[model samples]
Target: MSNSLQYIFGGPKAWDSGLWTASDDRVRGGSSISHLYTHPTQAKFYGHLDTKTLGGAGFASQRTVGDLALDLSCTEGIKLSLGWDSSDQTFTLNVKDTIPGKREDGRDEAGVSWEYDFKAPENGGEIFMKWDEFKATYRGREVEDPEPLKLNDIKRISLMARSFFDKQDGDFKLYVNWIAAVKKDDNDSDDDGDLKKHALEQRSDPRPVWKRLFCGLL
Candidate 1:
């Protein structure tokens, strides 16, 4: 429905539940569970997070069923359109440039992931996640000076609700309308330069565009 947008999900008809599967703490012997209920308008991600099962650490997530093999080189970043009635819980959006093979136990081998954590608006709205906003992480720990995300050949996507060091636990839900890659154009606002107050974007000798933006009045 957008001119400069390319949808990875949320198409013309009902969204497909077959494209996702729960990858929750249950696999790790924890009690948490999650599901993605698909519909024509949106998908609802609902789950119960039981941190006590694993000594106060738990996570619930729904991830793409298989490799996506998307080439997003042209887009500036990813965009998420949140449906109304979405919860205010912090959800992590993850992108993987590669998928590792499974161990003999059938558990996936841990690999680097690009993650962005955001709390959806109470009434739901659009959230843009610029490439610079994503952090390289491995098994939930930040990786310093890691190679930049392999944006061109993104292979997987996942949405997670996790106990942030016991900061959150219990029922959680998020309504997702669509997920797409967005391109900035002549008419677009360049607010991506606003200082997020996170680690500064990887610097280059010539200073990136964000170097010129001020964060005072936003």
Candidate 2:
């Protein structure tokens, strides 16, 4: 019964507020971004952490459109259903092809950061992160033998809740219905004939939304 991996975002034709966007940076101890309702089905991504506000770590981001060819060993990465409220708050799943270099540009920030460490389960439950149990760190060291996670150069995908300046904070909450990029043959059996019909005959371009939004439609 393992055939349920096909969602680009939160579901139900989701696209009411244009995917998402809000990269807060209120000095350091930051908190100022919120979206509580947008539903054809369900969509709620919130942010707030003002340990005092200054400038060093504050986040709220969303980006897409960078599928250079996505195959990552037939994809078996990307799956998030998050929930948080205090527990100090921290959630970052940043995929990159470049977007690093801060500290007021002092050189030393080159991209490659995968982080997943969330806590808000002291009797409350629901926070699952699986992209092969993500924990990659590059440019800061810790990404050894890390390769299988290529949603094709994945330009950008960010969801962050951070407040690192005023030391720590308390008010933070997050919730997402669905988000998937996983494949990894999705429980392969060895018949190799129906990989989505050989990925739709390797698309010779018949214009089904430009072969599902451009990407070697064949």
Candidate 3:
């Protein structure tokens, strides 16, 4: 079967689907909140980041429901269509492959997470990320001894706006036109050339690092 880009979120289905919002307020006595508003053409993620309570560390995020699992091994990576209203504020796109079972105390176990940070352009554009671009992190810290990402068992995807340890705070908004898996094209020569150009461009203009320890990688 020929590989093709597949829509994971946005459009009509996302409009009716349930997305759970998670904020640091639950853990730190802050009042930050996040919301996902979906329309036929796009999804808007907007929220407030309260840094005062935790001494300049706060975050707001939204993620897919627990039952949603996507196998994207056939694709190269994800491509996001950003809308005009998308801000230049840094945002992290996180993916999880394993969902650990709950502990005896009813809290969820910790698992490795793959994360990539990007800044959306003011006029909006397509952001393409190859599989290798995602860095491994656990419990918000970069893992030196990282495990390979399980592409066939993607469990969750999240969009987050964080304070980045006092780097930024306050209200935030991001407009996403769609999120899709980018499949390799059949024309190898043409695809290779395009991918090479894209990789060079991405490397030339790198995004700011959100994880302090991973600054060297950026």
Q: Which candidate tops lDDT?
A: 1
Tens-digit lDDT track of model 3 for 95-205 = 998876787876556768799899988898889888999999876689996878977568888898887777888888899988888765554224556657654644664
Worst 10 residues of 2 by lDDT: 208-217
* Cα lDDT of model 1 by residue, 47-106, tens digit: 998899888888999999777766565467888999778776789999999998999999
lDDT string for model 2 (55-142, tens) is 4434444434333233333455666544334343555566654455566645334557666656545444445456667667763346
Which candidate number would show the highest TM-score if scored against the true structure? 1
Runs in model 1 deviating more than 4 A are 1-3, 11-13, 184-218
Global lDDT scores for all candidate models: 0.79, 0.51, 0.72
Q: How many backbone clashes does candidate 2 have?
A: 11
Rank list by lDDT: 1, 3, 2
Q: What is residue 206's positional error in candidate 1, in angstroms?
A: 37
Candidate 2 matches the true fold with a TM-score of: 0.29
| Residue 211, candidate 1: C-alpha displacement in angstroms | 34
Question: Which 10 residues in a row give candidate 3 its minimum summed lDDT?
Answer: 209-218
Better of 1 and 3 by TM-score: 1
